[model samples]
Target: MSSDRRDFVLTAGKLLVLTAPAAAYLEAVETGKAEEPAYKMAEHYWGMIVDVDKCIGCGNCVRACKTENDVPVEPYFFRTWVERYHVAEGAEHPDVDSPDGGYSGFPEKYAAGDGAKSFFVPKLCNQCAHSPCTQVCPVGATFESPDGAVLVDKSYCLGCRYCVQACPYGCRFIDPRTKTVDKCNLCYHRITKGLTTACCESCPTGARQLVDLKDPKDPVHDFLRDHKIQVLKPQLATGAKVYYNGLDGSVR
Candidate 1:
């Protein structure tokens, strides 16, 4: 007998001895269908690549993140955001502003030949391997997943705001409704199902890319090998996974 026929016969024979649910199993076996394999966290080491020169300050990433994650619409709450930086020709620090967490596109503030070079920098959770937020969570509510995403357990959170204060990148925020600290998880729900992040999907300029460092075939390896990359707040030694290309020195 063919494999399908053999499977069907074996399943049918067992049906007489098994429970009603076996009927469903038999049908699946006969059709050569099986459940999707569970996602293996160990198989992936997730990260992100942001190309600064390609970011256009359009706020698409911010909008997509809020829409996908149901983050509070208030200006104070954001899973991801963008900042506009103005580096004056002789200024000591770059003038940085992110109005309403860049939910809306930025307005033109500098005129032509203002002697200030302006650019957009998109920001999100660094998914650090050695995240301070995880260390400061006294209740063990916040943690780094095996796949390199930083996640929070709302049920275990004490709402003490320790993690929020510990985050050097200003990425963590208290979800007012949940009364717990929340931050980006790199869209864990979508990524586990083989989908890219909402921010990456929405970026028109292809500035953002989701990467799997463990996958030898993933393009992130080639990109990293070829480009000069930097991460936010490297001095803190957070082991941040978000890599930036063409990062300016003036950026904080």
Candidate 2:
């Protein structure tokens, strides 16, 4: 192990008791055997591009995320979910719902030619550069990673739920198993290994795509320059990294 890695492990161990999996991960890193141990965090500024128009409400992404991250099966606890927005003609606000966090495909609620325009909006952690969750976390367990994903160290988390309340996007939830605040980290484990997120991988229509903002050759640059993309709740100015194309104004 490098001196820095050893020091980090030692410091982290001192802060809290490491779980078996966490301990094994530390051991792997010390031995230079961890998955993608050599990943250069500094080289990547991670984000995501969500093509709003392409999402078909298939619920494939939600199911894939749950399977990949082991999210709680119960309703209202999700690392990622999809919401269906129905805007009645001439209505100011849209009626939004996510049945089972959209784990199962949405049922047909509105009849054809009902004068309601409905669309599916997939939701996850914004991965904000100025994240309120990190600020509100008293124990420093919730933090933004160097590579731009907001993450939580479960061992250090106090399960206080402060971060959950501070989040503007309602993306966080308390894990039933661990009793800790949890949200999407953009599949940090897979991304560090140069693989796409499970949600992105499962989307048959390619609605979600993992992006590296700092890479000059990355196609995200072209997409951003060519398309008029917007972040959810841009008025809050959270510096959210996730960009949505073809987003409707009525979405919340």
Off by over 4 Å in 2: 1-36
Model 1: per-residue Cα lDDT at residue 149: 95
lDDT score for residue 166 of model 1: 89
**Tens-digit lDDT track of model 2 for 111-207:** 8889889899998998999998899999899899999999999999999999889999999999988898889999999999989999999999999
Give the poorly placed runs of model 1, Cα more than 4 Å off: 1-36
lDDT of each: 0.93, 0.92
**Candidate 1 overall lDDT versus native:** 0.93
Candidate 1: Cα lDDT at 63: 97
lDDT score at residue 77, model 2, on the 0-100 scale? 83
Each prediction's total of clashing residue pairs, residues at least 3 apart in sequence or on different chains, is 0, 0
Q: Candidate 1 on 107-187: residue-level lDDT in tens?
A: 888897888899999999999999999998887899999999999998999999988888999999999998988899999
Query: In terms of TM-score, how similar is model 1 to the real structure?
Result: 0.86
